[model samples]
Target: MFRISVLARRYSTKPITSYFKLFPQNFPHGGPPQDSFIINPKHLRREYRNLQSENHPDLNGSAILNSEVVSNEASLSEVINKAYTTLKNPYSRIVHFIKVNHPLHLDLSRDEISKDLIKKFQSKSTQSSLAYKEILMNVLEVHERLELATSEQELEELEVENEERIEETEAEIADMIKYEIKDWDELMMTAIRLKYWINIRNGIKEWEPGKPMNLTH
Candidate 1:
């Protein structure tokens, strides 16, 4: 279901600027695509370090940037840094890979909208259908809470919830990839949800990292 092939690859190609490109061994065929997004941490870290050093202006190596062109080295270094940063985390890594390689959309099945928890969406629908309204409602709830959460306590709770959901989504992604399922609807749904919650958390932190969030009230 997930990307065993990608991680199992023996070798990879050299990447240009795309963060996913740095770890060609992870996805030799292409970025994620239909494969799993799981990458070995050791591989990623090693590649990141190598890329940084290779593109770094201070480093006097074969990857030497054009000294004649002012700021050329600096520009190259910045891009490399950005790429590494994005690919380091599973969340961002998956997002970046899919965004760059796959632009198509897949939705969750109807039976998936409802989860295991009672008073929830599970057992509420059938297979091969989408829970459109329920999905919209949940997304709305995320935005509402994001805009209203100001207190540190509130932020903490929100973080916990988001973290759990992210883990849940990732687990689902792994399972689906392992199973080698055909329809990607459920996988896409989880990925999209994780992306949304992650953005909400980042936006909040950036807008009110140290400031008193109680003012949001």
Candidate 2:
């Protein structure tokens, strides 16, 4: 199991810079420099617990530090919780990575990836543009099918297929991030696809007979 004690010791005398810095083990290349997409969830959870334990405001109260440092510890504790959440989910991790390293590549926001945006992308001929459009279309198709699905078996079959799609996209994302770092456009499109697939997976998991599908981008 991985622990955050190394990170704590390394930064004990200095101000913590970024959330990514709190878990050096997860991104050995250092924050945005890390190219890999996979992380061990078990390790992440363990590291999170260790980090929270060391940084929790109660653990670093005024008895051990000045008022200013205690206040900062409270804020740091909150940030530690958020960092754990962002790094635990692959989709959010990708978003954070791009936001930090390649801000311009995020062409579309969640609200912008609707029917109107799909039609707009159709006019563009770039590979990334086409790929984004195809992903959006597929997500729409799946949404329609999910809304129309009548029986548990139909939903189950869709769940299996969508899970497979999610796995395939995850692998593609890992390869792209590792070897196609310069292809920001393609990577962004693939990341968007993965996001939608994850949303669909959640919708399937929460499905209830006769209830409308609740798939969010």
Candidate 2 C-alpha lDDT tens digits along 32-100: 545366778898788778767855643454432332333444775676677788878777777666655
Worst 10 residues of 2 by lDDT: 7-16
- TM-score to true structure, per model: 0.52, 0.69
lDDT of 1 by residue, 1-217 (tens): 2233442252222323334544455556544544456667788677667656643433443322432212444575676576667776655665554434332311111222213111222334653235645655676676667667668798788778877776777666666556444744355556655665566566566546444332110
lDDT scores for all predictions? 0.51, 0.66
How many backbone clashes are present in model 1? Answer: 12
Best by lDDT: 2
Go through the candidates in order and give the clash count of each.
12, 0
Clashing residue pairs in candidate 2 are none
